[model samples]
Target: MEEDTDFRIRFSSLCFITDHVGFHGTIKSSPSDFVVIEIDEQGQLVNKASDEPIYKVNKMLPEPNNLAKKTKLDRQNLSFEERSNQELSTLAGCSDGDQIHAPGSEKEDTIKDGTSEGEEGNIDVLGSLLDEKTDELLSQFACDVKERWDSKTELIGPSPEFSLGRILDKNQRTILHSAIRQKFPFLVTIGKNSEIVVKPNLEYKELCHLVSEEEAFEFFKYLDAKKENSKFTFKPDVNKDHRKAIHHFINKKFGNLVETKSFPEPNYSADNPSVVITVRFREKAHKHRKRSLLECQERKVIYTAFTLRKENLEMFEAVGFLAIKLGVIPSDFSYAGLKDKKAITYQTMVVRKVTPERLKNIEKEIEKKRMNVFNIRSVDDSLRLGQLKGNHFDIVIRNLKNQINDSANLRERILEAVENVKNKGFVNYYGPQRFGMGRKVHTDQIGLALLKSEMVKAVKLFLTPEDLDDPVNRAKKYFLQTEDAKGTLSLMPEFKVRERALLESLHRFGMTEEGCIQAWFSFPHSMRIFYVHAYSSKIWNEAVSYRLVTYGSEVVEGDLVCLDEDIDDEHLPSSKVHLVTEEEESANTYAIRQVVLPVLGYNIQYPKNKVGKWYQEVLNRDGLQTCRFKIPTLKLNIPGCYRKILKHPCNLSYQLIEDHDIDVMKEGSYIDEATLSLLISFDLDASCYATVCLREIMKHDF
Candidate 1:
């Protein structure tokens, strides 16, 4: 192993998300399950790893048979709702349509479900009763109307009348299949043999009905409470059949629990009922925190993780909150909670209306404290603290009062503290602001206010894209136009209307050059094709591709040729070390990745910008038509990696493309922002070590 000259070439730089946005399963593409590749200085290939060549390795499960449908599998079972199909004369299946939940606006937008707005409580009486023949009841059902904004599309919008899916990621597919094994639950099936399959034609909102908090809570609360008391303590108050159905749903959704029983007193009631109720069940039976994390996003989402550095302390929440405070996060933003001010912590956070840079700038402008911004990453609307399902933390503690607390005592205390925090939930302590040395306001009060504010921001993500960590990644993904890659599937007709619109909204707040665009996300790329008014026009109709189109003037593609055009002289294509090989050459041929994105006649290219002036030149040469951009950069000599000895000379001229393969996304969906953060793979590792060695991560004892 040591014999290999280049480690980067020899070993893989594995990025484990430990968290990310939900799978775009229905799109028939997932970032996970693909392969990996590494590039060199001139954008040459340094290494490659193809995880899976044949996409959709697991085909969709086959349709169930009458005799086969009768018996459910062991790890899976049908909900009582499906069992009622027995009374139906015919199995009224679903139709072909997109699965869309009506979207709600920020101020007073309401979800367009059969359930009532504001009064989600009355859903029990307002929504139609579950029936085997969904075609019948859905025909009569209408979603509740409420005040809403015309801002943008939404997630929980009115459920699509019809939609079908091919088995994509086996993980999510299995979740859906296990939820309802019998009758086709939304046509999603997991065979008794564990294959994920879908029916061609489908019926109405049965899947939505399964996760609907209203019906789920009603049955499970009763079952959970009864199980807690004694045996067979069945009650007839809440329809017996309904009780069984709820029990079954809970088992599937929350995993299996101890002998199920109905709650003696329902969380919902006749008087004033709460729209949201936190039910208590045996902890052992609990599951779905990860699956349901995204569901709770409508409630509020926040993330907090950190990276340590000596000369600088990275406070992720502070940066995120400051961005929102400055009004960038128009929708809203928040942290799961705050961290100790002295510690260097890097974490992902969400807000309804903040830009990534505004978040990064908070750290940038604060050089007065001998601290500088190390680096920060972004997440989608679905990214939150607990929502991450897991966390990757890098911290440093300093100025320890060794005499005040011994290592043994401190260790004991930290472990106990962690256990207590997890069990009872943190103190909800107000962040540094509570005491930011301001007359000592009660921490709880300030913390409560932050919580409320964060929730407001979280609920607002519903109006926009589910996630956006790598702005550069977004442009590259969209621009690369490699439809073959699963990540680019968003370009498909089904997603264009919504996903594209969201990208445009983001572009309005960021910058782009050619097919390569950069946001505060900070993606690392050796070279980028340049374009003016790239998203709107077709200037590079033959040269380079446009990353964004709605706001762009063109989609252009071209070679990242040498900077032949000296600012001193107007001639381009100079002593440029032409990347195109003799066999693959045509003075840099541009391919139209997506006809939707224009390939403009843009020709500005650079391995990396030496100064902001280069960007200004693109703008000057192209005028205002040239978009503005911001990117974080780290200049480190990466150890060269190896590639299998095959193929022609390494073509380092690799243009950025959307990671469309499932293998690339398996760890988690890599959004533009997420990808950009990866660019900072090497930066001040020495400083990071210094902080940790000094014990600077500890907080000021309250």
Candidate 2:
């Protein structure tokens, strides 16, 4: 009843009541006629009328079938009732003009005789019933996010391509049903009441058909694109959040040809073997006593406990939501951020620490096999959201260019870059997710509009429900629109009127006070913090200084270069893409480096001829001890003295080796010239045995 308070009649009808006097002599009627037209909640017709209900007068239409010529006085009004929809489904028929039956009643045509029958009627009835049920279900629906999947091979970095798949949620199922149902095939989630809810009136099949591969991208909303100066690189859309997908995708294409390398078990001998659990599962007899909360203390025994994967966060949230639906209060639980579905992830969840019977009952609801326990143990308390800090990313890169120019140099550069980032810092730019790619611009625009609307509401409206064209609404809308362009146009009225006025006002009175006012208002986090922060400064400064011209990648032809030299607007394909030359393709690369050995100062012997401080020190301290003790010289002619070589995927090696007399060492070794000649001389204190691969490129065209 309380819920129905908000429900009002949507359709109107008239109830006719006739009052006739049976006169034998003369037929006479009242001179004036009176009628009453119904009013809505506020006693107004569509809220346009005055507060008072209006009365009307008009001649009444006589009932056609009544030969007595009886005039009808009708009251127009909206009718409604509070009743369960269950009765509507049970209904087998509706009044067909006061039970007027077809001439085929005797033929037992119940449908024609105002009774629901036959396949057509049954189909209609079923459809209606389904419609009602669907509506009832949707009314109670909250929020639902879909888990996407891939069906074909996907290539990820460091691995060969492999196959992809997915698992969907119920709302996705609903969308699928709706799409496959009737006239329209798409089910769009519309924004309202600060939430995105699915549109109503879609049939089950209609919704179902909407579960499509291409259509799914429509769900991503748009956002405003930053200016050209900003480093807004696009991030590829990761379908389904499947972590192992890229590896699988890569493996598929080159799996048969590429030989598999043996992955031996780790050689670390654990010092703390006690941390390992000997028994993973326990039998019923060894389990603890348990009871369910729903039953009387003595009546209910704990059923059993089961483990869930702790890996996926969504699985945890799903299980939690499912448990709430099943009236089961999880006694114990633990999880990290929602893990990707379809991936074999591990998580921990516990039912009440009750007996086997009660646990069994709840465990029946735990449906997913992937969710069961890997190992069960007593954790101090249930693990909540974001308990884990980060993940260990393991990767493998394969199928690189065989003949890479300066492979050693390139490898060093990449390794150095990685080390540089790890040591110094990375650009604190936003990840490439702010822009919605793959999704059509319309979706992104809508999202941007929504964001702008919210910003306007927060900044301008604050709280109000006035006309959108009102000064307050207009002011809020002003903030929502983009603030670029040299001058406002005078063509259009709706938007131009405001723009032109604002432009004139700006010209006459200088910039709007709100710009400064808004800045001041946005200060705490937006002004003071952002202004003072190095990250913001870096972001803006880098934006101002974006450059990418390498030493020799220049063009001699007429080049329509942009103001920013590296970013030429007229360049073929545009600078947004990382364009590499055909030669560079044979040697595509990025780099990183790690210094395992810390530098401790230099160990310098008298260069045999130095006039520096060391020489001066020796001269002063030892009183010119010019005795040639041979400097304890080490002829140290070590033949075949090659340092240990460690192989890396990119095929480059580095090591510590003895600094030497280049001429003597070059002539001293007895190894083959080919391998021996490759050993370049290093004039450093530390030595290195570098294993280099002369990367060779081969392209096959059959």
TM-score of each: 0.18, 0.20
Model 1 lDDT at residue 343:
37
lDDT of the candidates, in the order given: 0.26, 0.23
Count clashing residue pairs per candidate.
115, 81
Candidate No. with top lDDT: 1
- In angstroms, the error of model 1 at 305 is 24
Candidate 2, which ten residues in sequence have the lowest lDDT sum? 73-82
Please provide, for model 1 over 1-702, each residue's C-alpha lDDT reduced to its tens digit, 9 standing for 90 to 100.
Answer: 011121011001111111111110111022121111212113322122223211122221222122122222221221112211222112112122221111211112112212221223323322222234542343232121101111223326443332223434434333332222122222322122323333322222332343453442233223322234323333334354445454543333332233244454546576533232223333332233675644444333232122222122223333433432343321233433233344333333343332334445556544444333332433333333222211222221211122243434333343343333223221111122222322212222222222222222211221222225454335334543432222433443331322332233233222232111112112111101111111111122111111221112221232233323221111222243233333333432422211121112233332221222333343354333333222112111212111110011111111112333212222344344222111001111100121111111122222
| Tens digit per residue, CA lDDT, model 2, 1-702 | 011111111111111011111111110011111111112222232112222212221122221222122111100000001111221111111111111111222122112111222334434543553456654443333111121112223323532111111213334332322221121112233222222234321221121233332322221110011111222111222232221232222122112111111122234234421111010111112223564643333333222223343222235345544334334322223333233332333332333333323334444445443233322322223333333322211111222221234334323343343333233322222111121112122112222212222232222222122344665344434443533211322222332222333333232223344332221221111111111122212222222112111111222111112122232111212223232334433443312111011000112122111122333453344232342221111111111111111112221232212223223222233432221111111110011101011110011000
lDDT of 1: 0.26
